[model samples]
Target: MIIRLNDMVFYGYHGVNDEERKLGQRFIVNLEMQTHPETDSVIKRLEDTVDYTKVYAEIREIMESRQFLLLENCANIVADKLLTDFPLIWKLKLCIQKPSVPIQGILKSVEVEVQRTRE
Candidate 1:
């Protein structure tokens, strides 16, 4: 089964510039994972499948734990954490968006997407 989480937004200090880091900004995160239930029969219980609430909590923890200079690093960190925390998840895709980037041009947002699988 495939599980997706979209537009999970958070305020964090992550950027190359000091001002951006100090001021912080809104970050939108999209996460997708491919996995299956431990049991062969229908997944009737939460214990048989990956718990997305726990996953969201983990993402929130990672986003709030520290500062990152690059969104790539941030996404990678999330991917690593998810893979480590849930062994049943074989593949994952993560996207992070910086909506209020300090750029001269009028752009909606800057985003980075990353895909990872258990090795």
Candidate 2:
């Protein structure tokens, strides 16, 4: 089974620039998780599957807890926590977006994607 949480927006002070750290910006998180639910059985109870609300809470906690210098680092932290906290999650793909990048060019947003699988 798969669980996807898309377009989760949060304001976090995560960037290499000093200004960005002081004045936070919006961060969009997209997480896709592959889980090992009972394939042959019905998911009658919430515990039978991954609770996305709890997953969202964890992600929010990670994003809101501290400042990060790079989106890659943030993604890594999130992936590690998720994989560790939820053993059912066999794999995950996390994407973070920075819309207001302090770059000298026209762009939609700066995005970083990371994929992790449990060994």
Candidate 3:
């Protein structure tokens, strides 16, 4: 089974440029998690599965905690946290995006993706 959330916006200071880290920017997070199905063979309930709200809250907490110099690092942080916190999850793909980046007006945003699997 898989649980996924796409394009969730977050306010964070994660970038390489000084202006980016200082001024901050809007970040879009896309998380995809692969996990085992809930229940043994009879009970079927959403509550039996991994609650995405908890995962979202964890990600939000990270975005609000400190500043990161790179989206790749932040993405890795999220991926690791998910795998660590949710033992049922076997793999995860996390993508972080910076929208309306302070570029030379050539592009709209920049994004970084990281994938992690349990050992």
lDDT of each: 0.88, 0.90, 0.81
Give lDDT tens digits, candidate 3, residues 1-119. Answer: 77898888999887888987888878899999877544334326766566788999999999877799878788888888888887767778888888767677788778889988787
- Per TM-score, what order, best first? 2, 1, 3
Residue 102 in model 1: lDDT: 85
Clash pairs for candidate 3: none
The candidates, ranked best first by lDDT, are 2, 1, 3
Q: Is candidate 2 or candidate 3 better by lDDT?
A: 2
Provide the TM-score for each candidate, comma-separated: 0.92, 0.94, 0.87
- In model 3, the worst 10-residue window by lDDT is 35-44
Per-residue lDDT tens digits for candidate 2, residues 14-78, read 99999999999999999999876544266668877778999999999888778999999999999
Error of 2 at 43 (Å): 2.6
Model 3, runs deviating above 4 Å = 37-43
TM-score of 1: 0.92
Clashing pairs in 2: none
